[model samples]
Target: MAGSVNQQQAVIYCRVSGAKQVREGDGLASQETRCREYAKYKGYCVLDVFTDDMTGKAASRPGMQSMLGYLHMNASKGSEIVVIIDDISRLARGLTAHLELRQSLAGAGGKLESPSIEFGEDSDSVLVENLLASVAQHQREKNGEQTSNRMKGRMMNGYSVFCAPVGYRYEKTAGHGKLLVRDEPAASIIRKAMEGFASGRFETMAEVKRYLESQPAFPNIDGSIRQQVVTDLFSRVLYAGYIEHEPWGITRRKGHHEALVSLETFERIQARKAERNLAPARTDINADFPLRGAVACADCDAPMTSCWSKSATGKRYPYFWCQTKTCGMYRKSIRAEKIDAAFAEVMHALSPAKGLVGLVKTMLHDAWGQRLAQANTIKETTKRDIAQLDKQLDGLLDRVVESDNPTVLW
Candidate 1:
């Protein structure tokens, strides 16, 4: 009877609430130790141990999954395998997961075992197990709710919660969990930009972009500060020493971190925004004359617009006209042919002379030759590295033949 009992092979399964718990505490290790002791008392041979460092509430766990796959393999046929756990809750947290995992193991022909509870065929035992699983799930959810409440309390006390914005970086202090700190050059640069805008030095966001482009330290995407980034930067209230996150019901609370600009300056910027918002939308220029604003009216020296005019015979024609009301040529159409011909003549005359073109080509060829020399140097360096790597590989292969360890060859 004892010899037959020793034939029963078992795999131990253990779980913790989180990976942190696994590292800080011996939750997984302790569970395995207890499970192995129980398996030994039952005259069982322990084949493997599976440890999960994640929530037991989920149906999926890496270790548990691997153990299941190994136990259910074709080679394990005709052998009675038991999945031994310290407790049923170690297998799962919620009632759903507990029942699901139980059924799954049964389908895989794995007998469930624990030091605490006996695997029963009766309905009462199953009901007790489900109740225990429900308790574990409730505990897990309660802990999560408390953690969220703590974070919300911290936010309500006026500490920044999310990842730091562009001009700021998150720092950990002795008293504070996490707080924002001004990140250099970028912070000073942003502060200067904000002050410039508020003081009317930068009239538009476009002007601010031009200022940023002139700066060597401004963060840019593909060597350019995006217009939308500049526009979005103007609306951040954190620059004014306040936080305004609406999701947590927070609105303009004073943050612990330093401000880039004063609240009054921020308000003035907002006023400028509101004032611009009230302006009437500009009508789009006619695509018939794409160069209306770009090309000046030759007669009045003002920008020219284009429109179609209908003759008495009902024939329509497009012509360029001036937009200035005070000018004598205002609304007076210039023949489209005349404007088109002038533009073409200007463009043609702007090309470099033949001698200057040859000089530019020579300069370009000299630059190309320098780049070619750099490429050849890089190629030689790459070839040397490859040759060294090949020698190392050959030496390792020779050692592997002499070494007894199969892993050396591998």
Candidate 2:
């Protein structure tokens, strides 16, 4: 029996829930050391050590699977190998996962052993193991709940607890834990895109997509930003320095972070999205067909569609024709040159009269004078307000310095 025990081989398995444990603490190293010590005490030869940096709730672990395969391939003809662990909880924190792994190890010709508990085939030993597994499972679930509650509580205090959006990144602050701060050129680019869309500079979301794709700094998959990403950017209220999470029951509230765009601009974007059924501008609308949609058919009054007609001689001619099937002149070709000349003539006729031009300039001059006067008045008022605020601030500082009474200061 002693000779057989000396010939037995053992494998060490250690697991930690997260990378932080491996980095900040010597969890895996400590577990392996303990397992190796146990193997030495049992007089078993240590074959190998496997480690996992993953949650115990998961049944599939790379290290665990590799160890199982090793056991299957290396078990001697009639001898079973011992699998050593620091504790049962190190194997798995979930009851289902523990049971599944237990069965898997047995099938792989591995007899489970841990320094904290002894493995046995008796009914009493099995019951104790199951109870311990259940307790570990409860601890994992409780830890998860506590983490979630803390994160939600921080979010309620106007701090973003989730991953920072594209335009922002989290920074650790003294008073406020992790707060969102503007992230450089990306923030500037996104601000311009959102403001442009709100102000009608970008007539459709397609224009916004193109604008983002043009910016080399903006992240893109396959050289183009997805339409869904642009939509999500516009939908996020976080750009306006606000936090909201519908799933967490959080309502829109002002955040500590600086806003990329004003609240007014965000509202404008929402209004524009609700008001328009925007579609991508046709790719064919270019210098060649500048009047494609602007020019209408004389018979149907519907906008004309332009196309280049190719003759048998292999020469192309630009023509504008009505696309409306019910129109009397539907598909009736009109020379684009003729349309262009007529358009120029109409524009000339629409030009302001010489006398009206002078009158319009005079009116604009008067409006400019009025605006200057209003601006000057606002400037003086702002100066006075700033002086008053400075005075009040000085008074408060004086009080704080002179008075030692904590109650009065509070």
Worst 10 residues of 1 by lDDT: 277-286
Instruction: After the best TM-score superposition of candidate 2, give how far the Cα of residue 34 lies from its true spot, in angstroms.
Output: 1.8
* Model 1 misplaced regions, further than 4 Å: 1-6, 74-78, 161-174, 182-241, 259-405
Residue-wise lDDT of candidate 1 within 102-181, one digit each (tens)?
88888776889898988788999877877888898887788888987887787778787766887888888777768888
Model 1 clash tally? 0
Clashing pairs in 1: none
lDDT of 1 at 9: 74
Instruction: Rate residue 138 of model 2 by lDDT.
Output: 99
Q: Which digits, one per residue and each the tens of the lDDT, describe model 2 over residues 1-410?
A: 13355478888999999998989999999999999899889888888899999999988999999999999898865689899999999999999999999999999999999999998989999999999999999999999999999988877888888888898988988898788997756787799899877765565677788888887667788788899999999999999999889998999999899999999999988987775432344333356777654777788775566778899999999888776677899778899999999989998889787799899999999977855765665567669989999999999999998998988677
* All candidates: TM-score: 0.53, 0.67
User: What is the Å distance of residue 188 in model 2 from its true position?
Assistant: 1.3
